[model samples]
Target chain A: MQVLYFAWVRERIGVPREEVETSAATVADLVEELSAREERYAVAFADRAALRVAVDQTLTDFDASLDGAREVAFFPPMTGG
Target chain B: MRIVVQDAPFDLGEEAGRFAQADAGVGAVVTFTGIVRNTAAGDLKAMEIEHYPGMTEAALTEIAERAQTRWSLSDVLVIHRHGHLTPGEMIMMVATAAPHRADAFAAAEYLMDYLKSRAPFWKREITADGAAWVDAKDEDEAALDRW
Candidate 1:
């Protein structure tokens, strides 16, 4: 599956997108897995309350199922318009 | 409905002029334009907007569809720009046309409210000292409760 980060999350993660080989069933599980990989991921995922998630390009909660999903994105609350 | 997510700057007058005035039944046309502004310190140089390419369009379309379903709107137009934008430049605009003033006004406000928080766009301010991301406001999120 592919995971993406945006805004300051992208800055902190040091990459916008990456293809991850994981068997996580939910967004939270995926975050936990990623956070375990390195220090930057740990820091970026430290405060889950400050982040938003999207599963397959649709806005969703961290508990959302990643069943058959191709993409997941994490970012701060949008500040558009 | 016209939805435009572009990197090029748009002229409000030209876009407003091209809006659908052809339908005589459309009695009220309400428009709102968002402009970039310097910080209170007045040292900001530009606002860099970043957006999720595919998701931005999809999210905007969903918001527009919701507006149309909730109101008796004849037309809706949304235009947003991404990339480096200087202070005072227009960032985005929404125009709503309806048979009555009430629906037009309500739908326009709804669109603005949703676009501000729902769309997958982020804004960063570039100042003389440094650059920083603009934080989302609680009021912007609360505005959706009115609908």
Candidate 2:
């Protein structure tokens, strides 16, 4: 699976996207696994309320199931018009 | 329906004119263009728009399709620009053509409201001090409740 970040999350995480090998069944579990790896991931995922998630290019919740998902993106709320 | 995600600037007049001329049944065409605004301090150098490559087009198309389902639209056009944009430059535009003015106007507004919050694009305002990500406003989210 690939984990992606955007906006400030990408800045904080220091990378836009990366391939991750995980057995996590849910988005939250994936976050936990990544957060445990380094300080940057921990800092970026520190405030979940300020973040949004998308699974396989579709907007979803942090508790969304990642079964057969190929990509997961985390970013701030969109501000486009 | 047409959705264009690009780093280049788009001509509002040309796009609007072409859209209005597309369908002979189009009785009304409503176009809205969003511009990059300077910060309150009047020091904004540029506005950087970041968007997911694959999801941006999908999200815009979905928004346009939803508008079409709800309104009597003949055609819908959405063009959003990414990358560094200076102040006073056009950022994006939405044009909706319908059989009547009411439908055209309403559908355009609905598309704008949805694009503001639901799209995968994020904006960062660059100023002399620093660059800051624009926060999504509560009113933008609340605007959807009316529809």
Candidate 3:
């Protein structure tokens, strides 16, 4: 699967985007997997309450299913104008 | 529906005229323009905005659709600028038109709220001391919950 980060989320994770091979089937599972990789990932996913997730291209809840999902994005609540 | 996401400053009058000309069924037009603020109180000198090429547009289009469904809007226009922007510059514009003010106003606000909390754009500010990434505001998320 492909994982993407934007805005300050990208800064916290140290990368803009990446591809991940994971056994995770849900958005929460993917977060746990990435959070285990390093302190940066941990910090990025530190507070799920401050984060927003999108499955494929639609805004979704963290518990949303990701079965066969091609792309998953993690970012803080958007503040665009 | 007309959505223009660009990096240049736009004339509100011209844009409004264009959308008005697109259809005559529109009786009320509600437009919202976001501008760069000179004083942010936080660490900010100048700001730079970045967005995901295809994804940003797709998400914005979907948001416009949602607004359309919720209102009797005859036409919609959304224009968002990218790259570095200074104070007083236009960052974005969202306009909605309907037969009544209620529908036009609701649609415009809905699109703005969704764009504030859901769009995939990032803004970074450079202050007198240093540069820092802008964090999403809790207020933005809360605004969406009202709808």
Candidate 4:
């Protein structure tokens, strides 16, 4: 699966997207897996309230199951108008 | 419904002209455009908008569809831009046509409220001092509950 980041989350993680192999069952679990890889991921994942997630391009909750998600994105709350 | 996410500038007058003619049976057409504003410090340079390409279109489509279901709209159009933009530049526009003025006005406002919070686009204010991502306002999220 591919994991994507946008806005300051992308800046903090130092990349926009990455392909990773993981057995995480949910979005929170995936965050845990990614955070264990390095300090930057840990820092980016540190404040969950400041972040929002999408599974396969649809806004979803952290407890959302990632059973067949092709992509997951993390970013700050949208400010679009 | 037409949903556009583009980098190039859009002709608001031309778009509005076309939108008003979308349905001859419609009696009212409401259009709203958002412009970039200078920072309170009065040294703002430009605003950069970022969006998830695939998801941006989908989300706007969903919002427009919801508006269609909620109102007696004859047509709807939404255009939002990304990339670099400067103060006074047009950021986005929404138009709704309905048989009555009240429905058209209400639907347009509904679209604007949803677009502010539900859309995937993020904005960064670039000033002489530095660049910073604009935070989503609590009021924008709260506005959605009215619908």
Q: Which candidate has the highest DockQ of all?
A: 1
**Residue by residue across B1-147, what tens digits does model 3's lDDT show?**
877777777898899888877777778888899988765565456778887767789989999999888778888889998888887788999998899999999889899999987887877777887776678787887888988
Residue-wise lDDT of candidate 4 within A10-73, one digit each (tens)?
9999999999899999999999988998999999999999999999999999999999889999
- Fnat scores for every prediction: 0.91, 0.89, 0.81, 0.85
Q: Could you tell me how far off, in angstroms, the CA of residue B147 lies in candidate 3 after the best superposition? A: 2.3
**Per-residue lDDT value at B7 in model 4:** 90
- Model 1, span B24-130: residue lDDT tens: 78888999999998799999899999999999999999999999999999999999999999989999999999999999999999999999999999999999889
Stretches off by above 4 angstroms in model 2 are none
Instruction: Give the range of the ten consecutive residues with the poorest summed lDDT in model 1 chain B.
Output: B15-24
Backbone clash numbers for all candidates listed: 0, 0, 0, 0
TM-score-wise, the better of 3 and 4 is: 4
In terms of docking quality, how is candidate 4 classified?
A: high
lDDT (Cα, tens digit) per residue for candidate 2, span A21-43: 99999999999999999999999
- Which is better, 1 or 3, measured by lDDT? 1
lDDT winner between 1 and 2, please give it: 2
Score every model by TM-score. 0.98, 0.98, 0.90, 0.99
Error of 1 at B73 (Å): 0.4
User: What DockQ results for candidate 4?
Assistant: 0.92
